[model samples]
Target: MPGFPAAGPPGGPQRSSAETYAQVQASPEFAALRRRWRGFIFPVSALFLIWFLAYVLLSAYAPGIVNTRVGGSNITVGLLFGLLQFVSTFAIATIYSRFAEKELDPEASRLRAEVEDSL
Candidate 1:
């Protein structure tokens, strides 16, 4: 246990970790951070899910369209859609990384420091 990280502040009469986190969670800054997170995440997630489901449904119920050759090239509509899935995944990751770095990280760092300082 000597080298192991602490589970939390040493158990005592001092305030519980939950109370501290609850304080942070109740803060307006935390609320805004959460809003920003949910705003970006929920819509993007829904859109991506819709895009993926459309592809799957098309492949299942509309093979002719999915299998159609694009511009006389060997690439089929299904192949293009499949490739777009990978593209969209990478795009989303990149966007999230940028958003977190630009917007979330600074606020989160400040919040963490506040908690640590309070401890």
Candidate 2:
């Protein structure tokens, strides 16, 4: 145990090893998940933040864009957004796929194996 590296804090990312391990002990799956998915989470969060803010801004100040009609059958501008919403979700899934298969899954799997081996 002396040679094994410690973990960090739970709830969120922290600078200390104790904090990280506290997190690992609390959620064994997340310990490895955090390592693999951390990279994806940050940028994804930022993108979501920007996306949310854009949606808020559009809904608030850009009502015209939200209500613009596309077809004679009374297509609202927001209806177009439903399509974008699906696109965005799919895009995020795609991004996660690349990250998971390429980096996160492998690292997490390796760490998980290491942890299991220790047990």
Candidate 3:
């Protein structure tokens, strides 16, 4: 096959998959890429979870607050908070897309190239 590695002689092994994986995992570029990914993902995930929990808790324990009118309008605090959830979700997606484009995509591409070359 064009892309597949050549088969070894009968009863013989070809390249070690473990060794190939270890080499890729051991690369400094791969390490840095992982660190950068986790650095952004963990904190953002925690923050969003906290924000969502807060909204849930407030709705469950303090209906009065959430139900309060907003500036004498038909809108309620709970309604706004629910809408804000959507807003925050979209905002986070946008921010992450930008982050990936600026901070992650290039490094990821390089790492992919390295892996392909190794293969």
Identify the leading candidate in terms of lDDT. 1
Model 3 residue 119 lDDT score: 55
Candidate 3 lDDT over residue span 68-95, tens digit each:
9999999999999999999999999999
Give lDDT for model 1: 0.85
Tens digits of per-residue lDDT for model 2, 8-63: 34665434545444545566566656755776788897987687678768878999
Clashing pairs in 3: none
lDDT of 1 by residue, 1-119 (tens): 22112335666456657777777888888899999989999999999999999999999999999999999999999999999999999999999999999989998888887776665
Give stretches of model 3 more than 4 Å off. Answer: 1-14
Ranked by TM-score from best down, the candidates are 1, 3, 2
At residue 16, candidate 3 shows an lDDT of 67
| Comparison by lDDT, 1 against 2, better one | 1
lDDT at 44, model 2 = 90
RMSD of 1: 6.6
